[model samples]
Target: MIAEENFSSCETPFLSISSRAILPHIHMLMKQAIPCFINYIHSENYKKKNLNEDDLTQIYIEQAQILIRKHNYPFNVNGQYRDITNLSKGFSDFYFFPNELGVSTNSIYSVESKRLPAPDKFREKEYVIGNNKNGGIERYKNQIHGKGLNECGLIGFVEKHNFKYWLDLINSWIEDLALSNRNWNEEERLLEIESHVDFCFLHSKAKREEKDIELHHFWIELGNGNSISNSKK
Candidate 1:
């Protein structure tokens, strides 16, 4: 259960991925995420194992299954839930919902998961791979420009310096959806939404509603071409 207390620090313009239509895809993605993480981690230890790149990747993928099981959802280090709060005081690696829900029609709910503060001015941010070391990941934050929106009021993540691009893209998509006055199938709409959203803010799924319409869901994510980052960008 996502507690009320967890949503306090969410940034503005809430977006939510409903659990209805996207539950299956979300489950699949979550299942695969562990292996990906493991592969990334083991990539650094190849010399110790005397393994080649491909061999290390296979080992990492296999180990990822164990890692996922090791730390299931509501993941805790000690007793505390391991959420967005990493070393930084701000929420980075988890999701957020809005503090309030409006009673009016066409109300939009917000939910977001974000990484570190990758500033727009700086094309790259420093990621520490090990103790006292920093590595620069390539900048792939340009995908947020002019992304399309779905029936649900969800916007995809933008590149580091392109928040304005995502804003404009989402707003335009929403405007188009509104003008059409036609309901879109959630998955199709989300798929269509992909061409317009940024990989940086890749949304797994989403839903929004108001008094006039029933709640709905959309499934989505950024494609490989656009998804670049030190941490699964």
Candidate 2:
């Protein structure tokens, strides 16, 4: 059972604590869900010879829902919430619904997923950085602001062999940001915001005639105040 003190009730939307406070719990939830996902993928019942991006995405979403139910999380699992004025969907993939029925963006958790096309090549910094724009990070950035969500969880799917290298690349990116921004103290601020973002990579070793299969997950802090754009400048 999750300790009461570890998580703040959805009622307190403007709670002053750093957003990072909830990350560990989210990580724990995802960690617990990963094994279930692997089992399902490898199960005899599963028979997708060539899993497309959408196929894998649906599996992840389903697994997340299962975990949420198993733990009796306070938040509702799935629904489409929209901003009538903007005519934009608040949570594209899924969101943690607050107790109140209304769409109070700040009170919920958001999740997004992306699949890596070439997992083996993803280890190279150039490949990861170049592909990021095409990989849907930009779309996620837009969703973050348009929805007014406090944070978003990003999931990446890749091949098993590429898992370690891909993770190393991400670490290098963070480290590089820190080194480059050392003079401006932006590193500390960026890392603090990064603390609120949780990343989880899930890889699969199933032999595919064409390509490798895997998945990764990340929880990103969103909204105007958390933008990393300014820090880059």
For model 1, the superposed segments whose C-alpha errors exceed 4 Å read 1-66, 73-164, 184-233
Clashing pairs for predicted structure model 2, backbone only: 154-218, 155-217, 156-216, 157-215, 158-214, 198-219, 200-217, 201-216, 202-215
Please list the C-alpha lDDT of all candidates, in the order they appear: 0.28, 0.43
Model 2, C-alpha of 118: deviation from truth (Å): 4.7
Top candidate (TM-score): 2
lDDT tens digits by residue: candidate 1, 1-233: 86557656655443243433333333343335433543444454432343222232233334434554565421111111122212212111222122234311121221122223322224222220112122110000110110121212222222244444433444454445446644322222222322323222223132223112121212123222222334432
Clash counts for all predictions? 10, 9
Return the TM-score for candidate 2, rounded to 2 decimals: 0.52
